[model samples]
Target: MTGFVELARAAQAARQARPQVPLALATLVQVDGSSYRQPGARMLVDAEGRVLAGAISGGCLEGDVAARAAEVCASGRAARLMYDLRADLETIWGFGAKCDGIAHLLLEPLTDWRWMAQAEAVRGRRLGGAVVTLLDSHGGGATCALLDGDPSPAKWHVLHDDARLLSLPELLPLAHSTMRTGHALLHTVADEMTVFIEPLVPAIALHCVGASRGAEAIARIAHTMGWQVTILDHRPALLDELDLPEGVMRRRVRQLEAVHSALAELPHDARSAVVLLSHIFDVDSAWMTATLPLPLGYVGVLGSRKRAGQLVEHAEGVLAARGTPLTARLRHKLYAPIGLDLGGESPASIALAAIAEIEAVMHARPAGFLRERQSPIHSRTPSPRVLERDQAPTLPEVPLRCELPEHPAE
Candidate 1:
């Protein structure tokens, strides 16, 4: 199953285990002007008021949501929250927010586990699917359906819709929009039309090799960034000593063989990033050489540039002899001497750089000083033209006169 579906299933299972528990489902209903999260983004909140599935906003909005979730859990009622980052100076300052847009969050109580179960069933089918919910319409409720068969140009059926029945052709376009939050499809058949859409779950995963302090820091930051983190280390003692979040998975594996086995088990997708900080040169080298050929989102090596060059050379020689072609694309994907140019020697700083670089690569952005780029720092507004044609002065031509004062001066 996909990560999003698994998260939904997990949250559903958690709620099922404790029927009395109240769950709040926070979804991004609208994105006006500009915002961190787009429409249809969702985060599941547990009865304890803890975020179980996704992130609504950054840290700025989570705390308030947690508090409000507690209240909803206690009251067993749904609530709608609208956070406008551009409200007042005091309001923005109080929330520690600076976004110039508005985000609408629907914190609904998950009192019905049956709907969740049905959603899980649809997800388990492994087919392209969508969940359509009518927030304020003639048919007001959430319904999920699976798109049977491979996604093609043709449309498919949406499993559950009691208010209005839709054919395959009518629902396919809606499925695509359902990948984002609050996106809907208005289908016109005969004289009537129905709107169907839902939010998409974000795809992100974190892989940490070695239980070094740097790895711990990366895991912590990645967790906050809404990544499913898995920590693999040779030393069991190191794993035991580390303080990691509950979401992070720790695996005890020794030697390069174990590393290869672990990587082979992961789902190869663009949403996954792997970081190697094994300290041991031979182990790190071996893992890199073996895994370089595999399709992965990002692969980072923790070491000096000199050491990384040596390792790359060794891998190239070995792979060449084995008749495996190691191309430039593969080499570039291998981030040796990982992280941005933070210029800090400490583990924490190194960790920061590593995570930053990973994020940069994942987002297809360059890891450098923002001021150096011609692109806008945050928003994508077109740069204003300083010298427009109408604004430029059309000076009249003037003949130059040469003065013969040299003889007189002499």
Candidate 2:
């Protein structure tokens, strides 16, 4: 079972044990600045406003969410809360504390079995789709099904004032977290006024190709991040050495044929990320040869530049013979010299950098040092905007001074 499945099960158990208590489910539907949970991150809050499962933010924000959850449970109404740390004193006092960047949370009282049933059904099918429509917002309610389909709406449920037709092709590639605003429309897709369709699938996956020290660290880090980690290695000794948890799957294979066979058996999805950290170049070559062409979220390989280049060259020839053109984007996605520029030689440090790079790639971000970059450390801008309307101003270049400020002569 996945981490989410376990969380659901635990929440169910808690609910059963305390039948009298009402449960409020709070999910971090979207994040604007640096926050702990990403989009679709969920946490179960009991009637007493206690956390039963999941994390929505770092320790700084959970207490406030829990308190609000109590109020939500007391009243049967759903609340769309935006937590911003940069708010003025009045807003901060009203919202409890400022979180700096905005974190949009959907807190709904879980009194109906139907909502839980829908979640359970999605979990059983392992299908990823979002329920888009604001419960309290101004937009009309309409659910968009995101399963692989033609550019047409499939099933229509409850109708509201603002009906908008959206082609699935136009919506899939765009980030799912963003929403637009507009009036009701029936024909063409609108760029504005659409509630985001949030998928139920976890946006993180751990793909381990070799059971080396690096692989072990990767698995551990991914587990902490609530990702589903799958370990595939040819050496039984490597698996035995790691002493991984029961949740992690260990696949034993000798050749690329075995690896391909194993991957073919499993269902491939956008949320999955594949990492090949095997010391054996042949095994790495075989895995890369099989995975690179597939539409994977992220593919990382552990090796030096020279070694990765050689493997890629061989793989390209192999793929070319099969009539599959290896693109440049796919090549860059396959990090031969895996990990960020952390200048680490140790296996553990290398693993940290590799996992960091994987997360950065998953989020479509640059894996650079935050201190070195001039941009806001945590803020994300969806669109560029002019800061001022006037002409561009130039400042005189100032010389750097190493000495301390001199005392003024009084």
Among the numbered candidates, top lDDT falls to 1
lDDT, candidate 2, equals 0.61
What candidate 2 gets wrong by more than 4 Å, as runs, is 1-7, 27-41, 55-57, 80-84, 87-106, 113-127, 137-196, 267-270, 374-410
CA-lDDT, candidates in order: 0.62, 0.61
Top TM-score model: 2
Candidate 1 TM-score, true structure as reference:
0.63
- Report each candidate's C-alpha RMSD, comma-separated, in the order given: 19.6, 15.5
Task: Encode model 1's per-residue lDDT on 1-410: one tens digit a residue.
Answer: 33355456766677567666677777666555666665556677776867676677765676567667777767755566777767732464454445677776667666543444444444434343455543433312333343333333332333333324443343443454444222333234333533335423334577887898889988888887767788888889999999998778898877667766887676445557778788887777777777788777788988878988888898898788888877998887888888889888888888888888888987778777877977555432221222232231332232111111111110
List runs of model 1 lying over 4 Å from the truth: 1-26, 43-143, 146-164, 173-203, 367-410
lDDT of 2 at 241: 78
TM-score of every prediction relative to native: 0.63, 0.70
Error of 2 at 369 (Å): 1.9
Candidate 1: C-alpha RMSD after superposition: 19.6
